[model samples]
Target: MKVNRFQVNVILGIANGIISALQTLWFIPYIKSFLGNEAYGYVSVINGLVNTLMIISVSVGVMSTRFIVVNLEQGNKKKASHYYSTEFFSLLIIGLLISILGIILSFNLRKVMNISSGYYNDVQILFLMTLFSFLIQLISAPFSASFYVKNSLFITYLIFICDYLSRIMMTIFLFSNGEKVIWSSALATDLVYLGMILIYYIYTRKNLPELILSKSLFKIKYLWDVMRSGLWVGISYAGNVMLSSLTTYFSNIFCGVIITGIYSAIMQLNIIENTVLSVLISSILPKMFKLYSNDDNQSLYNYVIDSMILTTLFIGLISSGIVVYGSDFMSLWMGKEFVKYRLLIVLTVIYLPFTLPSQVINQVFTVKNKVAIPAIATLLFGMLNVFLIIIFTKWLNLGIYGIAISAVIVQVLRDNIFYPLYLKNIINRVKWKLSIPFLIGVVYMALGISICFLVKKVIVPNTILSFSLSVIVSGILLFLLALTLYRKKEHLGG
Candidate 1:
């Protein structure tokens, strides 16, 4: 039997979430114990710096997906194939160039960032590790974009499993041998990612008929289109990297590395949450591209409304659950020291829903060929985030918590205000069809909060049992409420 979209999304989401939870939340304790807090902070900060550089070298993969999906929707298979082929080669070339450039520039990096002399070696190795990771990722994306269009989420999950499983094994090995933990960790896991990329390419060559190109994909038209589309994409990545990846460099100079570690843990949670949401939304966008291409306005409208409603319900439920239990669970995973500030985690729990609206809104734009909205929103958010961090960090005396709060505020502005405004501007309207999603989200959120409180009061201590029970009970209650509401609406000729 063919898997439905919901089944595919749920399976892949759960699979990846399990690995992420183990790798991120679980590994924190392991790394903190082995490397000590200061060392862990150093590794994480360097990792963040590397990610900032990577946003420049890579990140056009999303724009690649949008372009490829559009061509596929227009039934232009050969052009789509050529596009992916070009993307694969272009990204490899860029990755090699960036890696070489970074190595050459490493000598000046310490002075450029003004880090203490003691931390220079650590920063250099971290930069090299990050560069390698980017190369692996750049190669994976062209093949991975095929999976996105085909809804091969299981393949995506397999990629993540390879990554996290390597992390776990290496954590054990590095801890045992007293090796340089950061470099060992990076070497082990990045090799795993590259191996997975090789596997994905093999599969794509055999399985995906749409990706097979015979002649060189060096035609000027294809090169021009990819470059033009990817220029905006590069700018968008620059903005996102400014907001996120560059934070550690800024924090180290202006704030401190210990606090950056605390912030890093929060970011790990954010990544896991957003990754799940992206998997949920990804399936719909590809399908919606077809509807939009055919000029099926009604179907497009319904898809938009339903996607927002579902995302709101899903993310709101998660946020409430996290708010109630996140601190307790993380306290167990890491330590009380790391968990000292309940307020940051609590603020993060509150912030998840506010930050979630953009996923759907941005997808709406992607399917409709309006990529400029996200680029514009991300650019503005980037500038505003820098200003807020500087203001909150040095002046407010609020410390790390202030940074977290400022980050959340910027996301809320981007997700809740800026994204919708972009959508309305581009689409030139916001129907009740749009507002109904907002209202449905409100209802689900209210119900979810109530359920979260009840679960907190009644939940027991066994991890496996508690997780299973929560999933089951939440499913039943949500299903009944949705069924009743749908029936009532149908009675009124909805």
Candidate 2:
């Protein structure tokens, strides 16, 4: 039983995701406990602003991966190098400019964010450290792109695990010594980014030697080419950031800092689920891109359908657990105070089945270089999400729940309705009947939620150990059920 690259990548990715989630689990509570919820809230708002500004670098990174992989698949190493070099130099310039912008923003953070007079200087320091970390990541994006080119996400995940560990260790060291400031987290993050960038650079130079940085290889035309393909990716990423990060800013504005802190804490569960999902999906993307580039539409279609089912099942399992055990887990992890926000946790993730499976389809748009429409839809819906949040929170006085509800509505509209139809239109050669899998996904979610709730009723898990046991039992039962359903489908198809 020899393991393949994909299997290795998936295993490493899962491990990395778990580590990252644990880091979040520890980091969030530590910050809230030592620095207070207001400090944690300020840190979250600052980090959100940085993420919102990272759209350009993320777009460049994505396009660099796509272009590099596609060109390498075509046996054009020179073209791939050109794309890499162009992006590398471009990001350097972008990083410098953004650093300056971050400085200005840091000085005037009061105007943009709802910061208190007492914590203004501390928040500014946190903002600067976070901005510096982002700058490091921005410049290193091209180097990291090599892993995707080689389908070597195992290496990437390994590095990420190390980074997470370092952050945890640094935070513990800083906080234990009575340096319990919000900026300590950002300082830890900066060190982690510095280490990660060095590792990425060394790995790319040694293993992926074909990707070279040279002034000669950097072309204006190549920059134009990458940007032409990447602009939509940037727009789509902007929408995603708004939906996630900008919501934190809105929370500060509408509900106040204390509530924003609590909302940010609850959203950590959402972050963990997404971190895992993104890692799993990223493991398969190189293969998907390869299939598309080779004109293997039938195989690509099959691959996509399988991915949709698997992604849906995974999210369903996680969502069901959240819906059932969220309060118990939150009580154990954060404190009984957080248990009151259990409904917010449910709202944060309840729409995954409707949206995430469609995300698999949405990737096809990127593969086919047909992202304008989807990107526009995402941006439009993101704006709608903000508008609805304001209306619900202010006018209707729905408060924090308003933000969650708005997200669910917008996601269902854009991802559920638009993405599948758009995918059907673009992948026209394959006559993809998405209804079967879509219906199957619905069934999976319904059963998962119902059975998990039944388990909760049958076995009360008050303590941590009891909760762990309950989760294990329920997870295994769901796994077995999913396996049976998948095998039956395969048999019928056969």
**Which is the leading candidate under TM-score?**
2
- Cα miss at 335, model 2 (Å)? 2.3
lDDT of each residue in 11-77, candidate 2, tens digit only? 9988988898898888888887776788778878988899988888877777777888788777798
lDDT of 1 by residue, 1-494 (tens): 99786577668777787677777766776777766555556666677667666665454566666667777777887878887877777777788888778788776776546445666786677668767876788777787766666766677677777777787788788778766455666777678877888888887787677676444874667766766666666667777776767666676667676766676776666666677677677656666777877888667766776666666666666666666656666666666664576777777657666557567877776666566658766887888888888888888877766667777888778777777777777775565455555555566667776776676567653475675576457556665655555444433323
RMSD of 1: 3.5
* Model 1 CA lDDT for position 150: 70
lDDT (Cα atoms) of all candidates against the true structure: 0.69, 0.83
Name the candidate that leads on lDDT: 2
